[model samples]
Each structure stands twice: as C-alpha cells, then as structure tokens.
Target: MRIVRSARAHIARYGEAPSFRELAAAVGLSSIATVSYHLRRLRELGVIVETRGRVSARCPHCGLTP
Candidate 1:
C-alpha cells in the first residue's frame, strides 16, 4: 500500500511520523478519512502503529505491540 510505504519513508527520513493530513498529501490522497482507512489496514497488517491518532511505521519482523 502506498500509504504504508510513504509513511515508512517519512518515518525513516524524519524519525517522526507524519500527521494524517500530511500523509494524505504525500500519497496524493485528498481525504484524511481515506488515509485513516489505510492506516487501519496497515495496523491490521502489522506494518505500522497508530495510538490515540498518532502514527508511526513498524517493521514486519519487529512488530509493534499496539
């Protein structure tokens, strides 16, 4: 998924996660809700971590606890 890939790249480069709005723009998405959907999917797939609306990328092998 581009959303997960883009978020991972942003985290790797900046050492901080991007906001939902920033993520939407980076991936050419127009709606924050769409980004939120992708984020939920990513969490299910163990590719990222989202807690209380804050987000961060996670490695597949070193999966995030929450």
Candidate 2:
C-alpha cells in the first residue's frame, strides 16, 4: 500500500512513474518480483493498473482504490 502510494507520488512529481526496481528501492522491497507481488495486490484492489514495461497505467484520471 505504501509502495503504491509512493508510485502514485512519483507519477505526480514527474508526470511519470517508477519501474518495479525503482519502486522496490523506494519502498525498501527486495526485488522486482517482490514489487510485482505488491503491485498485483494493488491491481487486484483497483489501486493501480499493471502493464508491461515501466510506468504504464490506465486512467490515473480515476481514483486508485479498491
């Protein structure tokens, strides 16, 4: 949840978002796969959309929440 919130923050800061590794580092996760795990949860909860490659999301126009 903190990771996703941070990702949202990075996006807001730069009009872009972090890659999995970057998010992991930012949130103190271990690796990209771990990042993927939290990301999957976020996606499942409708907090964010996951796409292939870096910083890909749909409708950041919409609220990120379950």
Clash count (model 1, backbone only): 0
**Best by the lDDT measure:** 1
All candidates: TM-score: 0.78, 0.73
Model 1 Cα lDDT, one tens digit per residue, 1-66: 677677777877877788898899999989989898888887888788786566787767755222
Error of 1 at 4 (Å): 1.6
Task: Please state the error at residue 3 of candidate 2 in Å.
Answer: 1.0
Over 4 Å off in model 2, which ranges?
55-66
Off by over 4 Å in 1: 61-66
Best by TM-score: 1
What is the C-alpha local distance difference test score of each model? 0.77, 0.70
| Distance from true location, Cα of 14 in model 1, Å | 1.4
lDDT for model 1 comes to: 0.77
